[model samples]
Target: MPQSHPRPYGTLAVVGAAALGVVLAACSGGGPAPKASDLSSADRAKVSTGGTLRWALDAEPTTLNTFQADATPDTALLAEAVLPTLFTLDQHADATPDPDYLTGVEQTSQQPQTIVYHLNPKAVWSDGKPLSAADFAAQWQALNGRSSAYWTARTDGYDSISSVSQGAGPHDVKVVFAKPYAAWKGLFTPLYPAAATGTADAFNDGSRTRLAADSGPFTLSGLKDLKALDGAAVTAVRNPHWWGAPAKLDAIAFTPAAPDTRLAALRAGKLDVADLSRAVEDGTPVAQAASVPGTVLHRASAPAFLQLTLNGGSGPLADPDLRRAVAQAVDRTAIAEAVLKPLGLPVLPLGNHLVMADQHGYEDDSSALAPGADNATRHLDAAGWHLAAAPAGDAAHRAPAAAPVRTKDGRPLGLTLLIRTGSAEDVQVAKLLTDQLGRIGVPLRTVTVAGDSFFADHVAAGSFDLALFSWPAAAFPVADELPLYAKPAVQPDGSLNNGQNLSATGTDEVDQLLAKAAAALDPSEAARLTTEADTRIWQEAPSLPLFQRPQLVAVRTGVANAGAFGFTAPHFQDLGFTGH
Candidate 1:
């Protein structure tokens, strides 16, 4: 991606609004009135008195602290209720900045480097104190100070910022950065309150049970009694003093429903909206309910990609030929058609690039590893291994070595493939690959690891030969991919670099490309550079691209304007109850 150019936020906003308008128009026949099924008929008959809207969420908040939680999506969703971002992503993943929440941005002589944003004139915390820039500074400092691995990664965007200053007014704040950053506007999520500073350690710690205060559209009203609700649920009432658009529903009650229970609830007219995972959508109940006249099922491509990460550093995967052979051994087309297409459209191929087609950095030029037994044979043959057609047939064998039979470093090639235990699909894929490799005269072993240890301890430590994993792509830009593939660096405290780069493969070229693209202000130029970098990365094949998962949301027919934000986010704000 091109790194350096300047563009105004106004142009971006207009483009975003246009894109969203087009999507909304396509989804609805021109903003029809909300349906009765969207809200309870009893509630619809009542006056437009705002009140709580009970909601069911699958997971609980992992942490009350925003900066401390990065891996889990539940944390971000909860924080959205408490803290507001300067800009919100529309249904098309376009930036919709809230100027009312921000007074002005002060630019230093260094163009895009040091920007000091003034908060809204009347902005105040839930505790009735003015919110200032110092709060942001303190929060960032506290998060960085604690040395939590997840928080450190989340705050990586602010690593360039040198300092933050608070002026006389609580809303007056200044931010100084070490270098010019083009995406500075993207960093303005809500900050912590001043009271959090006193319990800084406790606030920054992910172990905290209750959050201190909120500054967004809703405050933590109360935790629901699971016994009464029959599931994990929470209620968030609207903040009366909210500076932005007031929430239509007075309160949002979240109820957790299992994958199976969701469809039944929707069929029984129990829920206004429900999230549909692939496992749920493929079942007969959901399929029948989706086709029903009174219900509207909208599906979109999610901004996430399932990937197969190759162990590139050492062990059996050190040889590029072996990796290529393994890549060719699997039938991705069949996987897509059998595993994913039933859920939604099989829109694009899983190319070498890790990003989905909608992402800014996506490059479609690359080709996918061809499927079938013949192609697999060719790859195995090229890697100096012969394929045996049957079990007892000594029909295939390896040729004599030039010197001695050796691996990448004149050693034997042997390794175990690791995958998460609970995922049946992943286990099936791993076993299939293992069988294919066995035919090519390569010994392979499969092992299942616990989910927590698999991602945290094993992958980071480079303990496995190959693994199946998924990576999320942000809607803003492709510049955010730095932490995943960048080379690990030693910390000041002599700790190992354990950001997100599980493979531990660091390329100077990739780093330079990403840095330049991020620094570029122009979207087109940045996109171009990002595409080039993506091409390079894909060709290298550190991670093999899998299918893109589709976003499936089932809403009552009466629900109006419910859709996804491009492939980026689920736009809950666009949802409203339609009267019958």
Candidate 2:
């Protein structure tokens, strides 16, 4: 996954446009979401640590390895509890070096963009081994993309590094970059111990060989199964080898619950917290969780977003105007409100490509749709599309389901839309979109792709006329934009590269500009170049973000430091329950 925020469901994003007014405060619907501080806080007066807090994951992870493309959000969250990454993002979107691991991190030289990392001498792996320079060197080689033995989904930041050398101390590491990369912090995230990623066989088999606590607040506890659990629930207790402030909770368990059953589990007090996203189910979980007494839904702005990717191949959507009209015809407001409002999430769409709504250097760029069905009709008419007159007849052709679909050159506008199964929200959104487009004379036929192989098979093969999914984010936004929109490239496995899988759409201009954005030394310059590239993306209308998808969570009233976390990973060491 290489830090990709994988979700079982989809989300929406907001963007700003001049004519349509693309500001965050105005365009994003719904009330303001909760602050990270709010959920992470306990009644300092009533706070007492040391109790088991049961949490719910959207799905069980296949492997404990978070670097694999097959890894899910559950695994990523679990990794945060065990892995000791060198850095973590603060609410301000600034990368802060974790004093628990690295005492210092800075770029010492600009000629080659040399960055130095100073590890704390007191910090030791759970196995009691010193966190040394060898660990850093091995991780760099395994992930540098130069080795074919390791199966890594992404190699953005690592690809820019020219060399890694030992620093003044045994615990110090100096890295030299081939080019200046502003998002350098992303390289060490979800970092694995050197013992795990040292060699080809070790990188593949070593990661899974051990799972007990090695260097985090909570260790495997050997209390039960750790990384070994998949179908069964995962459990972890306070690490006996911990050398820092002790973890608030004695043990934590990530119990798996189907989206439909999560609300019941929360109501039953079977779980203290659960990730109940609208993209997972319709709106029942939100309303149900709300009705439950002692439960509060916490939402924060997330980088993930729900979007409609129009096929650029031989389809009616190949026409940019048609794509723009589709954007207009499908009501974003209706979609967001219907699906997110009940969950108490913002309906505002994130319009920018380089950053999330709450993140710094982010602004709305999505308002270009011209804002309604009237504009949609205008665009369609311009593209030689004619709407069939209202069907006037008996029940066979009535107001419901029966309508005069669109026709162009005497051919009816008919298309098949692929929606992944298992997401109640996806099905609902698909139905709503079908109805909305139907009113506009666009006849949509919906189909369900197997959830397991949806992206690997259907999307990569371009076996779709229309598709809906979430565009997840990593610690760095620009790192993902290139693959998402760059020209399509096939991998050695014969599978479509995930980034180019969206209708196999790409352009040399987009690729070059994205590369420029990645290498830009000036922060303002990087933002400027990426924004310029976004303008072209808007014009092409390849895929437009609907809203800034809500990162929603329902937790027990007294629990603290556990809720809907955005760009930053959850700090399990600080989580606790406030009670006697």
Candidate 3:
């Protein structure tokens, strides 16, 4: 996968709307998302050294370890500056070996699918320990999924590795896969130090708040009081021992700032770079922020998207027909226009769940579930549900104030939709969905919950019939997203192992195609399989993709090599400010 952020299970995003609220006008004259990265580009020589880059973070990270379940995008940003990445994904989502960590990487064998990695001889840990095969083996052991002792967030490529050992020289590491494992380049990214993954206790909890060691261009310097939102929550200083190009900035301070506060922070010169991806809320003037003097507003097609997850573990959604009905009733294009158009982004509804719009092998799978109130009603009626107290075809059903309710076997066809409390975007989207579902005689209720405990206490716990959240995309979609849609299996102890598929519903055919996609060596074939799997997911109605969220950042005009990166990974060593 790309050096993308670690997958935070159901991260909520705050999107701002027009001052008059969501204008339900026809979407027109829109184009596909941009394929190129939008980071302000400049040569290394032009960038001056010895200045602090105060970057804004969305929130304080729950843990420093990227492998932990609670880790967020903040954790990934910290890892990118302070940890070594063997391969970095380009703007086209192609993986290329990073010379700072690996001189070369090649597949040496075909029978058992073996790969050899040539580690940079000068790359060493903060304590002077050389990076070796020991680090690779330790990470593999912890994330391979064979042992229950290690609590790993994801095990995509690692689970396929049969063994990791030393190869031709002391700096060469060999990895043998039990399967084809076409996404091998994604493994061991931001490779953890052996000391952090040497044992179960160390791997699970040791790095919750701190890093065991760092081996990159920068090192963790200090973590200010997290409760003090105005202070630097996390800081990284240039590493003098770095053997590659030295980091140009003297230090990077990650300060916690909400979407509404970033504009003021940037104008006051307190922040050098502010990520405005979540700066979407009601009555917020996002477009006018572009005129801020000495700053540039950059836009890039983000690898993340906002979506609605339909819980299939229990309740009315457990019935596939009802789930399909709910899916059909949603006007995705209208929702996209309401939330994204105000921010000056493309207003196209996302089609495929796995492949992003700007990526290769993308196919609109929305045709599987046709969107219309009449179509939704037909599905519900066929599933033995009928509107009670009023005629099924009455005109009053279309009214939002007194909509008719459906009932089957004395049970009302009512569902609860969960949204984070402070997210105006979530509230706006939910209200639209509530009106749409109500027209089909399905009563929908919106419930507000605390943002911090939203995912852990509700979404992950299967506590809602419908939930709204975002999923960050990666270069290797099949490897990264398989767990999200795979079927829950029964373990030997009669327990359920759902992996990360919170839907609680899946099919055998979907699983087979996803498995084939993971082991496919040819890129075209892998993409084809992934597209097919997405079609099935749409048919199953586990989740509905709304729109691709664009990454918008406000940065000082002189800042170089950093901003909205899109599909490309940020080159920390090349990021700095030019003293214009």
Candidate 4:
């Protein structure tokens, strides 16, 4: 599974930051080196080692616990450095065994969907517990969502497991699935040493400030409790017990800077890596960094897409025809062009709801069934939402001025568009939508909230007619995508099972195809079924996917082996300093 699920933190949030004054590559004193991307093998051989990397977390990672939804995007950085996963996706987005933790994985049974995992004999936790089947069993039980006391954020793969038991040896774990799962390779990933997950309290809140155990290439190096001062930050140093290729970097400092201040911090030598994905615009500090002494920029396709999930369960969007009309009236190309095209990226609207445009098994559902603005007006008129002369207002309010913002039956066609504030891209996109939808007699009022809280405040609650946000693609797309497009189910916490199922419009046919694709062992059948899933989702027009969100970063030249990871964990062991 080549899924990269970025949480509310634009995929990887900044956990914390204390601005320390420093310069760029010129200040760090590194000689000429490779490009900004991950180094080639030949190039890697010539690289130097042993230095610290200050990575900017886009937002403070709310929870270090990978089991919870609040974990920040950069949690992966800490997770990969500490906990070990059984398997990791490769550059090709295919599952590859992580030699440090897993020796082998085999499908043991077909009918009951049994799978066997062989743990590395030498793998041991920082607590001295041998990597055994017990850790897997504990993870399966705690994350299956069977216990009301367990506060797991995602139970996608775990929910399908029927049992997890030890085999001939304690290190051998056998998993029996009640239902077949396609991305089974992603299970028990970022395995917290059993010491951390043995109890519900520990599983939920135990790792709040610091991890209980470590087995990966790096261990906690400094203070866990972050303070206002630079010296008190939590840092990671090479783990002594790590059995794999020894980690090259001496240490990695987890720091945070306010999103707006990251580029400035990077320029002044306070930060080593700033996720300058959005900071590349003309006037931003990142844009000016090109002229600076030492700066390296890396760009790659993010495993995510931007979407407008329409809410059809209540309010003005409840009407199917109105929803369809809104879908048609939205100019997705303009949205992409305004933001992505300037960066030499694609402006094509992503038609597939599950896989990205660049991934396999994607189908162009938008151009096939989605209608245009003229057809949108026709459909609305046919549905009795007749356009009338505009209300008196200035050119700024010309949309409402040009047409009546309601149905003929006094059903007022006004709708609300909720978006995260501080995102220049989203604001520009929302404005484009407001202007475009308003032109078609559908008046949209835009509401902005903080980025970190946007999902909880509006998306999870299904509180708005329309919303704009991006979905960070999971590492296992088929196994993890169901919760996103499935029929809406409200949980005990009032949060939704599928927050993006805002319209509550997923069909039984779509669900069936999703399951079929998940279980289809045959590669061809899985692809076909996934394509069918895309087509079925296209028919409903519940959400409009705009484009693949791009991943871009500005890194310090002193660092090597730093760039976007497509569908796998970053191999921190290989990242080191080439500094003076």
Each prediction's RMSD to truth: 8.9, 5.3, 6.8, 8.1
Model 1, TM vs. native: 0.75
Indicate whether candidate 1 or candidate 4 has the larger lDDT.
Answer: 4
Residue-wise C-alpha lDDT for candidate 3, range 178-279, written one tens digit per residue: 988877877887788999898998887777666678888988734433333334458889998899989999888888787778888888888888877676
Candidates' C-alpha lDDT = 0.55, 0.69, 0.78, 0.68
Scored by lDDT, the top model is 3
By summed lDDT, which 10 consecutive residues of candidate 2 come out lowest?
12-21
**Position 392, candidate 3: lDDT:** 46
Task: Identify the runs in model 3 with alpha carbons over 4 angstroms from their true place.
Answer: 1-31, 34-36, 59-62, 146-149, 201-206, 209-212, 221-233, 258-260, 281-283, 288-291, 386-401, 407-412, 490-499
**lDDT for each residue of candidate 1 in 1-580, tens digit (9 for 90 to 100):** 0111111110110001110001111111222211111112223233243644444455554455545432245455566666656666543345555665676665554654566677788777777777777577766565434444323334445666677788556677777777656566666464656555435465545223455566767776354222343435656777787766655566666666655567777777666666565334334434664664466666656656567777776666666766666666555555555555555554354553534554433455344344455665676566665433333433356543322222333345455788766565666567666665555455667888875576656776678888775555455544456666676677899865645565556577877887777676556666666666766665555776666655666766555444333343333343345552
lDDT of 2 by residue, 1-580 (tens): 1123223333211110001001112122244432322255654445577888898866666556666555566766777788786777765355678888888987899888898999888877777888877777887888779988887655657777898888988888899999877677766766677877888776665565355335788876463433456556677788877777778888998788876788778888899988776524654655555666788877776656677778875577767778778877877768877876765565655566555666555655565446578888888888989987765667665645368777889888887888877767778889888998887788899989876667657665567778887767544556545666777667898754545437556667877887787777666677777677776676666776766666767888889877877667777778888764
lDDT for 319 in candidate 1 is: 67
Work out the TM-score per prediction.
0.75, 0.87, 0.86, 0.85
The model with the greater lDDT, 3 or 4, is: 3
**Model 4, span 172-194: residue lDDT tens:** 88999897776677778778766
The deviation in Å at residue 273 for candidate 1 is 2.5
Worst 10 residues of 3 by lDDT: 14-23
Q: Give the TM-score of candidate 2.
A: 0.87
Error of 1 at 437 (Å): 6.2
